[model samples]
Target: MTETMNNVLNDDKKWKIIQGDCLKVLEGFAPGSFDAVITDPPYASGARTQADKQKSTRQKYSSMGDNAPPAFEGDAKDQRSWTRWAAEWLAEARRIAKPGAPVCMFIDWRQLPAASDALQWAGWIWRGTAVWDKGNSRPQRGRFRQQAEYIVWGSNGDMPISRPVPCLPGVFKYGNPGKRIHLTEKPLQLMRDIVRICEPGGLILDPFAGSGTTVLAGVLEGYRAIGIEVTDVYAILAQERIVRELAEAV
Candidate 1:
């Protein structure tokens, strides 16, 4: 085991935020160390350039330009790159996740296939998919207004499985309250649902923990969370959010 893994094994804290590349940090964890995995990673939607500043300005009259920072610039281009990256992470997750542990990954419709393929290739049994319908979504120029995202749930082993809850569906609806810090911050309710389904009190891992939504959910649900964030800004924001949440709980 690596020094980082050793530290994690030694610590008994309920939550931790690790500022580093997920690929590197995942290497430090031992196989079957975590009980669950929930994450929202970059969609690799071929959106490298910043959004049009003028367009953004026109839409919201905000000082920030229309062209938001490219969320997937550091990663490779195309779905193939995303598939490979996700597969790599899933491989690590599978190793660190307990038998029959659930792994839930968030993705947009455009990238769902690749995400599913990546998870299957990484040895997870593709159980089913769930949808998050954000009621307050923006109007789309073409096609139906895109208001829904997806969560692909997989398991570490293949066998008869029990539903995490007595009654849960593959789809759910939530309001898009907008993100406070991260570009693609997931809703708290969504996180809460995932935690409820997965059950609490075990170590939950979020490899691409943007803005710390998953971590916050884990903390609130009484589960130990370990988050890895690539960007320094997001890392700081996640840590701040965790501290604030913990303080509020007291």
Candidate 2:
């Protein structure tokens, strides 16, 4: 079964979506095996309390587990412990990625400062932050509109640019497709834009490859990619998505 699945993935030219804990899965990879990492890991938003995520979404996960598509896991760590947990896997990702490999990690405004600190703690050079502005944001009476998320991006060491893409702006304005493949499904366009930051035709690693958009973007762009998803159900979905994408391209 494993070999057969591997062959299917290879048909897409080395785009792999593995089902396992990212921290455990990444351990098996040889040091510096990948050129870049563009991923969205679980945001440690709460410690013991569940993140105040949409209750409707939470209900879907609880009602469907295994029988239905996998729900979002992680994201419940408190600010203090979450940083420590993130640092561990981030450092691990660094070990697996080549020096000067670029990394882009996603986070909400609430977790901004801590996440930035985590990246530096993991030995990544803190370059700058990019904004993903979700067009048509929800506005509250007193609070500001909650329409933007951030990408804390940087290089493993020195910034390397063998294949140069046009300079992109710090802010991106795109709207959600309203399709819930995953509760927090990012736009395909967003991933396409971000993948350009990676080395052309180089191997890309997405350790927290929820729904596999990052890996899918890499493969579609002619780059080899490995996406490790902790939830096996989502792993299957991700692999299928990639396969379908590959077929559609042909």
Q: Output the number of the lDDT-best candidate.
A: 2
TM-scores vs. true structure, each candidate: 0.84, 0.86
Q: After superposition, which runs of candidate 1 have C-alpha atoms over 4 Å from their true positions?
A: 1-3, 9-12, 46-76, 140-142, 159-165
lDDT per residue (tens digit) for residues 1-250 in model 2: 3234323344546788888888877777777777888888776552334545423334533344554444667665668888998888989989878988899999988789988999999999989999999977667899889788899998889885554656777898889756657767788888988988887788888888888899888878888888888877788888888888778978
Local lDDT at 174 for model 2: 87
Model 1, position 204, has a per-residue lDDT of: 87
Instruction: Enumerate residue pairs that collide in model 1.
Output: 32-95, 32-96, 51-67, 51-68, 52-66, 52-67, 53-65, 53-66, 53-67, 56-66
Task: Give, for candidate 2, the lowest lDDT window spanning 10 residues.
Answer: 1-10
Clashes of each: 10, 4
